[model samples]
Target: MNKRLLWLLFSILFMAGCSVLSSTDPEFSRENYDSWYDKGEYQKALNHVNERLETYPEDALLWNEKGYILISMEQYNEALQPLEKAIELNAELDSAYNNKALAYNETGEYEQAIVAAQKAIDLSEEEPEQFINMGNALSFLERDEKALEYFNKALAIDANAPYAQYGKGVSLYFLGKYEEGIPYFENYLHSYPNDIDALWYLVYSYDTLGDYMETIPYLNQIIDNQKENPINTVDYKGLMLTYAGELEEATTIYDGIIEQYPNEAIGYYGKGVLQIQQGQTDNGLQSLEQAVALDNSLKETAYNDPLLSSVYNDELFKRIVE
Candidate 1:
C-alpha cells in the first residue's frame, strides 16, 4: 500500500509541472502581444493584455502599452481609462501621459492635451521627445509662439531630433516665415530621407515661395518612394501632374485610386481639379460635388484651388457652398 501511494504522488507532480509549463509563461505572452500590436491588431493585443494583466495587475508599463495601442486604434475615450489607470499606479510613467495627450488631442480636448503633454515632459527622462510633444500640443492650442519656444528648446537639447525640426518648421510656416521653415524641413529630411511629412511640407514651402521648379525633385522623390509604400503617392503625383500640365496622366491616376477606394474623397477631388483644369466644367462640378458630399473636409479647399476657378461662378458651386 505504501509503494502504490508513492507512485500515485509522483504521477500527480508530473501532471502539475506540465500544466504550469503550458499556461503561465510571461515571455511567450509578451512576445505574442508585441506581434499583434505590430500587425495593427489592437483588439487582439488588448485581449492579450487582459490575460497578462490577470497575473500582473500592478504592472504600470503594461497598462501604458495597452493605452498606446488603444490610442492608435482611435478609441480615445477608451484609451483614457487605461492611461489614467497607469498614471494612478505610477505617476512617473511618462509614456502614459504622452499617450493620454494624444488621445485628448484626437478628441479635440486641446487644453487637456496640453496639460497631459506638460505632465509627460515633466516626468520624462529623455528631454527632446517630451519637448516635441509639448510643442505639438501647444500648436493644437494655436499657441504658436509658445509652441515655437518648446520646439526650439527641443532642438537645443538635440539638434538632430527629426521631430523637433519638423515641429519648428511647422511653427515657422504658420507664422508666415516660409523661408525660415524650409531649411528646418530640409535638415529633417537629411536625417530621415523617407519622411513623407517632411517631403510634403518641402513641396508646400517651395510652392509658396513660387519656386515651383525646385518643388519637382522632392515631388518626384515622393512618387518614387511610393513604389514601396503607397500612402501619399497620389497626392504628390497629382500635384506634379498639375504643375507639369500632364492633366491626362493625373486624371488616370485619380480614377484608378477612386476605383480602388470609392469612399476616399481626395481622389474624387483630384479628378475634379484635373477636369476643371482641362475646361470640362460640368464633369468637374459633378466630381467636386461628389467629393464634398462624401467628405466635408474637402469643402474647405474647394473654392480656393486655382484649378476650380472655371466653375467658381456656377450655380452648383454656389449650392455646394450653401
Candidate 2:
C-alpha cells in the first residue's frame, strides 16, 4: 500500500462534520458558517470563527470549530491551541479531545494522540469514533495488535463504520493475516466505492498472496488514476504484468519508459531481466550491460534477480553483472 495514503487515512476521521457554530452569533449566524464549511471554504470559516471569538472568548464550541477549520486546512500545528483551549473551558468536551488527538497524530506525536483519544473515549464511551481514533493512533506507533483490538471494539459499537473497517483491514494486513484483511476492505468499498487507498491495499494484499490474477483490475484502476504521475506506476505495472505472464505487454511498458527516460537505468534493467526470462539471451545481456554501465549500483540487483538465473552459469553473464 502507499505510505502517503496510509498517513492520510490515519488522521482523516476527525474532520467529518465536527463544526460547532453558535445559533446566537447575531453578526455571523450558524447558517452562514455552515454555508462556508459546506462549500469547502475552510479559510472563510476559520476567519468567521476567529471574528466570533473576538467577542465571545469564552465559547468552547467556537474554539472547537476553529480547531476543526484549521485541521481542514492541513494546519495541524495551528489547530492544537484552539483545541486545547476548548478542553480548558469545558473539561468534558469529548470532541475537543478527539480533534486534539487527530492533530497530535498528524504531527507524529503518537503518544499524545493516544492519551487524548483515551480521554475522549473515557468521556464518551458510547462514541465509536473515539475508539477508531485511538486505534489509528496505536497503529501509527506500530502497535498493530492493540490497534486491531480497538478497531474491533469500534466495530462492535457501529458495525458499518467505514474508518473502523479500514483500520481493521490495515492492522490485519500488517499482522500477516492477508486473507482476514480482505473482507474488511471489501466491506468498506461497498460503502465507499471509489476509495483509492483501500483499493491500492486490496491490490497489494492480493499481490503478496501470489494471487496475481486477482490484482489486475485494481492495478488497472491505479494505473488509470495515476496518469498525471505516470512515472510512479509505469515501472510497477510493468513488473506486475510480468508476474501475471503478460510478457509482451510488460515489454511494451518498458519500451515506453525507456523511450521517455533514456538516461534512467531502471527501465533498461527491467527490460533486460524480462528479456532474459523470455529466452532472448544475447539481446538481454546487452541490455543488462548498458544498464550497469549507466548505473553501476544496478549490478547488485541484476546479480540477484531470479530472471537472470538461466545465464547464471554463463561466464558472459557473470562478467557483465560483475
Give the per-residue lDDT of model 1 (tens digit) for 129-247.
Answer: 66676676677666878989989998888888777787888888878788998999899788778766577778878888867667777877777776564635666667667877878
lDDT (C-alpha, whole model) for all candidates: 0.72, 0.82
- Look at candidate 1 and tell me the lDDT of residue 297: 72
Candidate 1, after superposition: displacement of residue 223 in Å? 3.7
Q: What's the residue-level lDDT of 57 in candidate 2?
A: 86
- Pairs of residues at least 3 apart in sequence or in different chains that clash in candidate 1: none
**lDDT value, candidate 2, whole model:** 0.82
Highest lDDT among the candidates is held by which one?
2
RMSD, each candidate, Å?
Answer: 15.7, 2.8
Off by over 4 Å in 2: 1-5, 8-10, 16-34, 190-196
What is the clash count of model 1? 0
Give candidate 1 regions above 4 Å deviation: 1-44, 225-322
| Candidate 1 Cα deviation (angstroms), residue 252 | 16
